[model samples]
Target: ERRFSVDLVGEVVRNFTLTLWNTYAFLVSYANLDGWQPAAGGSPAAPAALTDLDRWILSELHTLVGSVTAAFEGYDVTGATRPIERFVYDLSNWYVRRSRRRFWKSGAGPDKQAAYATLHECLLTLSKLLAPSMPFVADAIYRNLAGAQQPESVHLADWPAAEAARIDPALNHDMQIVQRLVSLGHSARQRSKLKVRQPLPEAAFWAGADAAGVIARHGALIADELNVKQVRLLNSDLEAVAYELHALPRELGQKYGSRLPAVRDALAALDAATAARTLLAGQPLALQVDGMALELLPTEVEVRLQARSGFAVAAEGGLVAALVTDLTPELVREGLAREVVRRVQELRKSSGFQISDRIRVRFQASAQIAQAIAEHHDYIAGETLAVALQAGAVSADAWLIDAESLAVQIELAG
Candidate 1:
């Protein structure tokens, strides 16, 4: 009955593989798996010390287990598949994306061990859940993650029962709100045409009292994802965004004919905020003009948000996330430093350097970029796993970022 898009199907498959399978592969690649016996995707592993982030993902995993289990029991294949897809997104984009540092940090400490254990458990459970729909991939992931700990194949493994004690509903609710705010922040960044790599000064949010607590708890994660220096709360949504009304000229012209201009004028005269609210609430906008009353559906008009000065804002479902678009000198320097690290990392990859390869870095750059390197020397060194950074002749590859050319070389640490 409805139009189908091959692209949509492709996107879903790609997201599922990249988030679940590829992420698992990445973890296994980096993980020091010697003597580590992964859990058999049973009840959740309760690490002695768990960060809020760790606990949050565990909660999500168990919740997914309960939902998928119920759906499969009812023979609702679609329901089972959909929840797995969503969990893959959360695990890949939110959990793994945020926890990459823990896995990559120099030492195998308790925190690192916990992370490995938690992720391993998740992938194992996910493979079992996916077995019915995607058998081959599920068996492959389960075999790798579980090793000799469980049945050789995922189909032979027992169903992962939901761990009631591990599923924290409150934590899940808070994380959901945090994810919404971060998603809005990303929209704002897209509108501003600024990439995530370019750090911004601050992001402000306006939401209900309920979400205030969530924002307070996960503000650091939000800031990290949005590439903002700080997260602030605004008392009102109007402070973050103003609505602008637009008439769909062609549609309105076809509907109103001779009265199209009058309709456009009426729309322009209406209070944008009130009109937007009415339309978003699924009510027709009522206008009185020229002694006539007219009601226009949401389809006849467009609503645009005008961000407050120095901010790029996105608002939806009563939540607003605004990013301060003005780049301060210090912020610009930090962004450049990140760009340099990214380029260096790319060079390392292209040069066939292993993830654990420590390197000596040498760079020749324009004055401004060189200054950025000087200011954030330790940061760049730490991020790129550079044993030494020196000013010298170019050797490897040259990259031009922000109109500044940087020639950099990285060699294995002696």
Candidate 2:
């Protein structure tokens, strides 16, 4: 019953993501099959045994779907729209980017395959949920993944039956804490104006018991996303979280004269959380400095944080850092492989390589990269469409440059 033009819808489509919208339509590549889907279909199916992580994701999805659908029924398309988009854009993008390879090479392995297949199924389920809001984007993803293989269009797929039985509440809460922990790091980067691509040596946080498990399970995810080498959990109480308080010693000293310490102490005595919120909200405070009435505005001071134990601690903007642990050689190499694929994909995008275009690539690089390529040779070949790669040879028809700290070239081979 809602009315808008194709142009308007097209414009809205541009604002949404393909994977996000695909979650709206149901099954991929299928047309007009809305009541049932490839996995659970419309009625209901018992979930195949899934990973705790996977089950947790499904639990989150179901939570969102019930709420989103209710919003839709109430004519709050915007409300329905936002959650699905966020889950796909945030959770799916973050997780899939971190775990794709385990699925890629699983072949017939049941557990790993289940891990991947569950995610894949989740993606489809989400696309159906989103299609009511964004048609074009949902259709494209649906067509690509399941369309040719099974379904005709994602839009026609039915909504999956809602089930809350499989969700892990503890995992969900822990994840939210971890998410907040990651956000604190990202906010720090924002304050520093640091681009995510730049790597950092380490980040340490007062990893409390509440967020510890979440951080442990996805510590690698945090490192990869934040470009930090190491994450640490420290039990310390004295590390200062930084922020501009309403009264810095020198600034307040000039105003308060002999009373500066008392004023500073009073301000410091306020909990970090309250001080930050008050500062952010532009709330005004009244104080007497040298027996003169003073009014304080929020922006006059700044804040930052360092880890502490039993300090009941936090950073300005309420950011709490999460620690990272464990890095394996295999993990590093796999990350490099993804970087190589990214370079290839970027070139393809720039040079107008068609979706199905076959290509050849040659790489010239240091021994380390050469070995990485040699080790993941099949993966590299499949990823880059490269017919051959050698340590010394250069491609005659290829784009050549550097990637993963290695010189490389790629082209359509004759």
Question: What TM-score do all the candidates reach, one by one?
Answer: 0.89, 0.61
Deviation of model 1 at 216, angstroms: 1.8
Tens digits of per-residue lDDT for model 2, 386-407: 6676566654333332333565
Model 1 / residue 190 / CA error / Å: 1.8
Which residue pairs come into collision in candidate 1?
none
For candidate 1, give the lDDT of residue 169: 95
Candidate 1 per-residue lDDT over residues 109-156, each given as its tens digit: 778778888888788888989999989989888877776656888899
**Highest-lDDT candidate:** 1
Model 2: runs farther than 4 Å from truth? 1-11, 17-49, 73-77, 127-159, 187-201, 207-209, 227-229, 237-300, 304-316, 322-345, 348-361, 365-389, 393-407, 411-414
RMSD of each: 2.9, 7.7
Alpha-carbon deviation at 125 in model 2, angstroms? 3.4
Best by TM-score: 1
